[model samples]
Target: MIKIYHNPRCSKSRQGLSILEASGKEFEIIKYLEKELTSKELLSIISKLGIKPMDLIRKNEAIWKSEYKGKTLSDQEIIEAMLKHPKLIERPIVINEDKATIGRPPENILNII
Candidate 1:
């Protein structure tokens, strides 16, 4: 099944969800903030995205700027930070089978779904 890690308050996330709905393919929505992702779960998503853990972070978030900016952190440390502050995670990560993509432009989801 396809899954979307979404934040309803984020415009980009909402756009992504709309795209998925329009696509007419079945998908699951994971409200990561409400459910909270574990370190292992987040790590697995990052792996599917074929990106470094830091690459999946919302670097401009206030929490990132205040707590983790300009720091040389290990991949595990960065993942831990995201777990502690889920807001630091980038929104609308869509996973289809073993493939995943960050729906920054919303259209990006079309490539996967």
Candidate 2:
């Protein structure tokens, strides 16, 4: 099944949802802000995305700039930061099977799904 870590308040996330709806494939929506991911879950997602922890961060978010920017953090530290400030996570992460993509362009989801 396809699963999307979504933030409805985000326009990009809404666009990603529109793309998923157009695809006609069933998907699960996780309101990540309301239901934050655990460190283990975030680590698994990073692994599936084939990227480092920083790659999944929404660096422009104030939470990051104010609290985490220019900090030398371990992988675990980054994951913990995201859990504490879920908005620091990049929006619209879609996962299908073992593959995952951060839906920045929204179209990125098409490649995985």
Candidate 3:
């Protein structure tokens, strides 16, 4: 099964969802905002994405700029921040088995699913 950490308000996330719908494959949508992920859960996602914690962060988000920018945070700290502020997480993260991708272009999700 495929799981999409989706934010409906985000256009990119919506596009990714549209793509998944068009694909006709069953998938799960995790509206991460309403149901925030725990640190361990996020860590698992980051691992599956094959990226550093910061790579999954939306550095431009207000939460990041006001509180986390210019701070030399450890990987754990960044992941924790995202867990605390799901909006600080990038949009449309798709996971399939052990593989995952941050679907920036939305099309990137195709690679895994």
Off by more than 4 A, model 3: none
lDDT by residue (28-106, candidate 2, tens digit) is: 9999888878878888888999998888898998889999999999988988888899898898999999999989999
User: Between which residue pairs do clashes occur in model 1?
Assistant: none
Q: Model 1, 15-111: lDDT tens per residue? A: 9999999999999999999998987899899999999998988888998999899999999899999999999999889999999999998899999
Local distance difference test values of all predictions, in order: 0.93, 0.91, 0.91
- If the candidates were sorted by their TM-score against the true structure, best first, what order would they fall in? 1, 3, 2
Clashes of 1: 0
Q: What is the lDDT, from 0 to 100, of the residue 17 in candidate 2?
A: 95
Best candidate per TM-score, number?
Answer: 1
lDDT of predicted model 3 = 0.91
RMSD of 1: 0.6
Task: List RMSD in Å for every model shown.
Answer: 0.6, 0.8, 0.7
**What TM-score, to 2 decimals, does candidate 2 have?**
0.96
TM-score of each: 0.98, 0.96, 0.97
